[model samples]
Target chain A: MNQIAQEVQHQTHTRLSEVSTEDLIVDIHGLKKYYGDVKAVDGIDLQIPRGTIFGFLGPNGAGKTTTISALITLAKPTAGSGTVVGFDLHDRNNIKKHIGAVFQEQTLDEELTGLQNLKFHAEMYFLPKPVAEQRIEDLTKMVGIHDRLSDKVMNYSGGMRRRLEIARGLMTDPEILFLDEPTIGLDPQSRANILQKIKEMNEEKGLTIFITTHDMEEAESLCDQVCIIDQGKIIVQGTVDELKNSLGNDFVIINFNSPDEMNLAMNLLNDLPEVNEVKSSGSVLHIGTKSGSTAVVKILNTLKEKVEVNSVEIKKPTLNDVFLYYTGKELRDDVADLSDRLKMVGRKKGRRGMMRRR
Target chain B: MYASTSKSQDSYNGFGIFTFIRSIWTVYKRQNARLINSKSQLISIMIMPLLWLVIIGQSFNNLLGSSNPLFSGNVNYITYMTPGIFVMITMFSSLFGIISLFYDRDSGYLKNYLLAPISNTAIIFGYAMGIYTRVFIQVLLILVIAIAIGANIPITVGSLTAIILFPVVVSFFLSGLAITLASRASNVETFQAIIMPISMPLMFLSPILYPIKALPDYLQWIAQINPLSMGVEGLRFVLLGKIYTDGAIIDIAQFNDHLAIFNFALLFLVGIVFLIMGSKTFLNSLYK
Candidate 1:
């Protein structure tokens, strides 16, 4: 019994030391990247704990990719001091060996087979031949690409290519993996598959993952911590529940046939003491409240005589509502219309900043 | 199954000289693999020199007899132009290999190299050396074709060594220029638009097709400073036992040995300069 206890204690100590005493895998203070007159990634601070999925959530042109590029040493920061895996930002080689990256764009060699691509990356990280071969086999199996490893990457489907890239990213068995829009062009099924593989990698290997995405559902479901960023700055950072509860615990969604009715409903809902926040996009009205049951009762009573409700939903708060609550604009890919819509939203509220950090 | 942290760290070492050479070797392998896999491209590259030897060499030989005022040696027209074709092969093979760079960039594959823990110098060296290897093979093929076609080239050890070593210097120079040009080009179209015109001028103004004397006096100066001309003349000196001097073809015995050494030295100097510049440009693009 004593020998068993000592063995268990030694195993625990070995695992803890292997993982490292440093809790933060990525810690950056005042990171910035600029392109001529444009401030692509304005000053921002981030701390990501090890063995967690931390999401940088933003819209298009929101500097999420730029920030990732800076952190990965693909782009040098304009002014900042930071460490990745306890090494300084300028110590790129050390940091690179410790981290893996799946870029927003496809970075796989189309001319090479999937196995060749993985081997090339393995060589870059200086993996021993046998170790590289074993890891390649293991990682391909984990990512469900074991069958396709012999095929050229060009012949792989879009989802298959993403899976191969994910496997390549893990060739080095990095402590932290940085994925920039890992599922941008993939189909819904592929996205789900990729997300599942990412989760498996994290859980099985105890890997820290930093993912940059504009996907609300992805961030909400996959991330342990998330930061909403816009215009090169982080608007807010917290866990999904913390961000959702910051706005409110419950939400009431209403869709109207006409913008006039939605505006009327918005005005009435804004006057309610039970409503924490109200926003309208097109003919839809979203209301944030403490109690979905009570708010729905008050909302129905207030809108009964004045406005005709098309459809209504009472639900818990999501990252979507949290984003709208803070940004005052909907999360969208159309950057051209985003600024114009933002201006109109700002004008409607008579507020200076469309999105403000709390 | 993953190893524990201590074992993993012991297994992976991103620093030190071995990893540096390993990174370069990996990049070099990728380039050669791509080169070998593209059958159509290889066929085209191999056929280009033969076409030049057949059409151009045959037409010039038939148009001008075996003996002409342009011929300062006992060599025939085909023999006279063979060295030029060899240098041209080196130039074309070197420049053509850079198209892969543009392709890699457009396909976003270059980002993988950039994100690797390797230094930029290793990437540049590995890529340049890969092109040199390609040029070496093409030059060897040209040598065989030149000899088979009855070009009166000497089969001396010194001449063969020159043939092997000179293309490396020429490729070093041309690939450097090509990569420097490619670094600033936004896409393949822009790169081709700029490179085609530059390569055409280099081909015409050099001593590849004709002796420097064949050009007008004003153009001779351009040919004089042209690295391609220097490369061709230097190869012509060792291969045909003749070198062009002051717009006149002369026997290698009459040519100043210092001038011959200067020609190679200048090519080496220019190659080193452009390679350094190209590396800087490539690094700038990464940071930017």
Candidate 2:
């Protein structure tokens, strides 16, 4: 962690000691939303602390968007309950006043100038004219779009439009901001720039941000906490370090010359005192263990006698590796299935063959 | 808690009727801005009425003779067709307003209004008001064009009021019909496909291009019941104080108030019914 991140962590620890239910900006339990027999968002729970960036990581149609719609009052829940920003879930207007959302799609009016879009949002929220004007100016400058405020949105580049959307979301000085794939299609540089701005917003303003993204790297680099959801259920959630640590502290892979040798080495490693589990693919064997530097020597000593190992390398667990360990599938592989299920949900909701996310 | 750094959460008084009106007004302003920005579309719509008054009016005047017994003394065909043209403008304006709804839907901008704190009724009312303003503007332009083309339209205070307010009511009813169709359509193509056939028949079946008495008996009955026909007759009464129907010139005051109050009441009632139906369907399409 960097110095400021460590300082933020220190503050987080101190606040956790005195944290009450009110400290959770978003608190929900057993939330469910069903379309006919399809449980688009099945039973799920979340308790996100204030001033932390939380990532809801999931593949498309894994209920990330559905859950957001339910919380933001775009969809009605079939069961369970929740509270957001000290208001009940059904208190939609009050909750909307305290929370802002940037949808996955670009929802800005292309014909309107960037400034007009921000002012219109303020009008919808009933912000006083003078207060709205000041915030609009401040937020545009913060997102670095103040100079282009007079240009129509259609004339904006994709990154500039995304920044303006973020600025608009902050126009009401909302307590919590919800971003659905905030940087999904931006270039690498733009993506990094937006992520930096998101982190800065969370740190400087103590804004509780709830983000959902399919990008694991974004979650790993930017989120203070993340939850992996699949098939409408949360598989795992924790701090980045904790989730990685949960999948064993180290991974040691051994490459053998033959399948016979790989099986023999896997069997030998199973009996070793330091190794936890051995998984084999092709001619290579992956061994999970703790204190990998020290354990590597002992594992090699045990294997050197019975097996002919071609090469051995030690690896650290990443968020992707943890996702694989928990979900038993690659994140990108399920995208094809996402569309079929989304269509089914749309049809069940009586939509006229349009793929409306909510 | 992070409340220390958080902005103060002002106590929210729940939305009242005034809040509802405010939201509608804001949406109205937004629609007006969009309409103003698209100058080409505005000019294109204005040209349609000009064509009707100049080309269609003169051609029919030659075909049907310059002096016809069906019209009041010395009144030409163009003067009689002007009110019908205004009704046509109102119909087109109201229906075209919902085309923007489809664009809003495709562009995802509709979600901004849908997710806003305002009720669906407010949004519908706002769109209706916007369409009304467009229809009013187009009618005024057509009136200027007609007068410039030598159509004799009387300009009394009552007639001026009717010209301004009558089209607003007619557009309200048509706007509701348009919204009802838009709520069920999945895309712009389907909406245009469905609206074209319905709109063409309504226009031809009404008395926009010719007198209703000239149609066959069954067609005349159909034209008489058309909402556009009611609007045209009311406008004709206010603008001319009489109408040429059934080969006779009947004064509205002597012929009972059916030309003014009766038709206005009918149009108002129809507008309310369609507004209710349209808003309900549109709201249903929005929510799960």
Candidate 3:
């Protein structure tokens, strides 16, 4: 854990202790997952309270999937241990029975109809006939795919497929719902719809959701608490605001038309006394500082003197900034690139979206 | 409403054999559902055996003449080749077991099975059942062909009843073997690459096309251990009322010398062994 996360952990520990250990839906201490010489999930300690949406934000190959796999008992930890839904990590059968998951990889049989997929799951989890049918109907209705339940999953749109998967994941009425990048490929409208349904599920049913994603804005909007991991270790773990405040660095996002112009603006802004960090993502150059509002005028004026600034927005420190700060510029680029490719992969084939821990 | 969000009084305690069987049945049912969508594939599967039976049976009979030793005691080339073709169909149809496994694993559907609260044994059993059910259907089609050809098959109730089990035995063992190979295979192409060399060699080397005694000494050694030969000889004995040999036919009767029972037991043992091995390897790969 980094200094900032450690501080947050220490602060949350007192309140967590008072709530009772039973309420700790996820409890991990020094969990490690190694593949040959590669340490996929290095030693990490963390805890998640019940009924909260916990977001795992990280760069590609940073071990977010590995951690989720370990917790879900899909992959064993090489060292250390944890408990999920009150079951030991090694007790995979116990853990599996209590949790539901929509993996980053597609897990549904495309040839089977939506109803058949749910029915298959319902049977595996030992849901009674009437109850299984009832739950399937309820889930389809809730996800708003009740009309297309008979259609083959291969025929369903990306958004509908995601909804079915989510419905199927909840067939057993799990204690913890694991959504590993639930909206990777869907259009903005579909993504927003799924996000809305997720919020409603959280509010109405009080389900604890564990999500892993590279989408910073989505994490900011949906996550109650977020953990940022890089290179198999947690760099920061706290609520959204806590992570942003811990950075104590705001940013001035200045969009420019050309790389040459952004480069000139970057060089000019870095020379300023108030600007702490300057990094460019495509045409947008982000300048970080102690106070973004105070530095905005100087940055705008300096950039205006050299190159035309398209737009200027001074904003609070975001999850993206936290990721850039903690995971390194190169690693964060890898994640951003991965997210772009994953969108295509998730749409093209159900092979795998999340890169395997390397 | 998401039941996962709303706490329900019904909770998981643990599952037992009944649930395990249900899980297996669900896989079996799901596979059946998938198979139903590809109706044309069924015709293609049946065509291989018909072509083999008609082409090989016809050409060999004419070339070798009707006086061949295999045709002795009312057993003609068609009768002799029927069982061999059935064995061929058995091996061919059972390949869907591995093919489906590769498809599921590659396409990520296996994750759903692994994540479920079911035993590894159930998954293997379910897969074997699913594949063999389709194999059984194909076997029935071949049986219809065998009957339509009027190959002088024994028409007794006992013989008819006994013959049905031969294909089932062949299918069970072969499907189990296919599943075992699939667990080790990384992808569909790899599975096919591995399967072709082993399956084809075993089929050609086995006494499926000729009497075991007719094989050369070196080839005979292979035939002795070959499961397909066991199925061919077993099916030949029960269905044709005679077992072809290098010298003469042995009358297939309980009193005279029925080898079908022995072959049946051996096939059972092989099936069990393969099922156990396949399930173990499959379960190991489940989380990997």
Q: What is the TM-score of chain B alone in each candidate?
A: 0.89, 0.89, 0.85
True contacts kept of 2: 0.45
lDDT of 1 at A161: 92
User: In candidate 1, what are the lDDT values of residues A1-358, reduced to their tens digit?
Assistant: 1333334334433544464437878878899888988998889877777899999988878898899888888888998897888899888877877778898877888777899899888887667788889888888998888998888887999999998988898887778899999998789999999999899888887889999887899999899888888889877776777677665468689989899989878887888999888878999987878899978988899999789999999888678877887776778768685687687555534321311210
Q: Is the docking of candidate 3 incorrect, acceptable, medium or high quality?
A: acceptable
Which residue runs of candidate 1 sit more than 4 Å off their true CA positions?
A: A1-21, A252-288, A293-312, A335-358, B4-19, B67-73, B242-248, B251-262
**Better model by TM-score, 2 or 3?**
2
Residue-level lDDT tens digits of model 3 in A205-240: 889999998799999999998888888988777788
TM-score of 1: 0.85
**Which lDDT tens digits does candidate 2 get at residues A81-175?**
77988899888777777788899888998778998898888777677777778888888998899999988897999999999999988877778
Shift in Å, residue A238, candidate 2 = 2.4
Give candidate 2's error at residue A210 in angstroms.
1.1
The pairs that clash in candidate 1 are none
Q: Candidate 2 chain A — worst ten consecutive residues by lDDT sum?
A: A349-358
Which residue pairs show collisions in model 3? A205-B5
Better candidate number, 1 or 2, judged by DockQ = 1
DockQ, candidate 2, comes to 0.41
Candidate 2 residues lying further than 4 Å off, grouped into runs, are: A1-18, A255-271, A297-312, A333-358, B1-12, B65-67, B242-255
